[model samples]
Target chain A: TQLLEQSPQFLSIQEGENLTVYCNSSSVFSSLQWYRQEPGEGPVLLVTVVTGGEVKKLKRLTFQFGDARKDSSLHITAAQPGDTGLYLCAGVKNSGGSNYKLTFGKGTLLTVNP
Target chain B: DAGITQSPRHKVTETGTPVTLRCHQTENHRYMYWYRQDPGHGLRLIHYSYGVKDTDKGEVSDGYSVSRSKTEDFLLTLESATSSQTSVYFCAIGNTGSPDTQYFGPGTRLTVL
Candidate 1:
């Protein structure tokens, strides 16, 4: 089974609409990260939340780590076509000294119509 | 971008052939990783290197092997290419203090026909 589960596998919305994508897990993580990927490119890190119940904002995007560190949510306000891409969430677990294992969710493919 | 590049951005090979992909970084980061991205499977780690000559397997380590002889380069090899191995591969470098924060290379698209 996938360790991390992401909701809304696919999404399509008009410009200016708001949307939220979720990443959930039954196990706790040392940190959670959000990434955005475009065609022909690798995923790019958007933000990282290290503490439980932590919230971080980047421009039009808001990211929150669950209080129990088992989940995270990414909310986009007034989304634009630029926001159209595959959003992925990964849970970070430090296996040992400085070696981290990242478990990625399937991801949410988003489309924003202009 | 982070000064990372994957050689032969795109390659097509036949099944049963051996193929090797290269990841080179100028950031001098101590940690390097290899991951595969396929439809329905966002990205899964294949292997990672903590330092030169040190490497470990990841979630999807089967059918794949890695070698890190230098701090700036990491190599992923497919002993025998299979149609199932056709996918985009990514290389990443991470900071020691914040391993979760990583920078990725453009990607290498490998088509095993």
Candidate 2:
């Protein structure tokens, strides 16, 4: 199984509608980061949640980290067409032996049509 | 957009041929990483470097290798390309350790026939 799994593999909704993307994992992480990617481009960092139970807001986006640091969620309020993209959540694990790599989820493809 | 530039933005090569993709960073960040994106696989790290000549394998390192002879350049090479190796590759740089924000390069799309 993938270390990180994102739910609602695909989502389509009308403009001004709300949506949520989830990322879950069986292992704990030191931090979790969210990124968004448009077609034919690299993913762009949206936000990073470090402490457990942390909540961050970026304009119409709200991000929350699970208390166990094993999962995260991203909520979009009144999404717009401009918000259409692939949402990915990556969890970072420090293996204690000079190894720290981020495990990425399959991603949630969201389309907000006008 | 992170002062990172990947060479050969797009390429089509044949299986059994060798290919090299370059990732150059002007930010002089200490951490550098190479990842590949596929349909069902979001982004899998192929390799990463902490400093010059210091590299480590990632989850999807098979069929791929990397070198960091210089701090600014990280190279991902397919010694003998295979059709399964075809995917869009990305390079990223970060100032600190994991969990730190990473700036990504415009990705290089490769097709192995």
Candidate 3:
């Protein structure tokens, strides 16, 4: 089973459209992160939410951490073709120490048509 | 500096052949990881090392092995390459005690025919 499940496995929309992606899990996490991956490259960290019920915004993208710490969401405002790529959500458990492995979601492949 | 580099950006090998991908870091972060990316499967952790010579398995550890003999080098080896193992491999380095935001390498595309 996937510890972190991302919805809308694939998405394609015209520029200026708004979209939201969801990441859910039954397990609580110490923190959750969002990443964007382009072809021939590794996933790049977009943001990390450490507190439950926390919300963070990165210009056109807004991220929310669930109050229960079991889920998160990413919303893109006025999406652009530059947003075309795979968006991934990963969760980290509190391992007491700094050494913890991140569980990744299959990711949502977003295509913003120009 | 959190600079992570993976060698052999692209490779193609036949089945039953041995393949090794190397991850080198200048961060000296004491933690290194190998992950494989496959279509519709996301990025799955293959192996991770907390320190030199101390490695652990991840969700998909079968048919793969790893070694970290030094702080800056971690190696992932496929004893007998198979088509199923063909995927883009990434290396990451991070400090264990901080926020643990991992820095990833460009990636190595390995194709086993």
The deviation in Å at residue A95 for candidate 2 is 3.6
lDDT of 1 by residue, A23-73 (tens): 999999999999999988888999999899999999999999999999999
TM-score of each: 0.97, 0.95, 0.96
Candidate with top DockQ is: 1
Sorted by TM-score (best first), the order is: 1, 3, 2
Tens digit of per-residue lDDT, candidate 3, span A1-114:
448999999999999999999999999988999999998888899999989999999999999999999999999999999999999999987554668779999999999999
CAPRI accuracy category, model 2: medium
Q: Note the residue pairs that clash in candidate 1.
A: none
Ranking by lDDT: 1, 3, 2
Query: Which is the winner by DockQ between candidate 1 and candidate 2?
Result: 1
- lDDT digits (tens) for residues B22-63 of candidate 1: 999999999999999998988999999999999999888999
Model 3 residue B76 CA deviation in Å: 0.6
Q: What is the C-alpha RMSD of each candidate to the true structure, in Å?
A: 1.0, 1.6, 1.4
User: Candidate 2 overall Cα lDDT vs. reference?
Assistant: 0.91
lDDT of 2 by residue, B1-113 (tens): 67899998999999999999999999888889999999998899899888899888888899999999988999999999999999999999876544256788999999999
Per prediction, the TM-score for chain B is 0.97, 0.95, 0.96
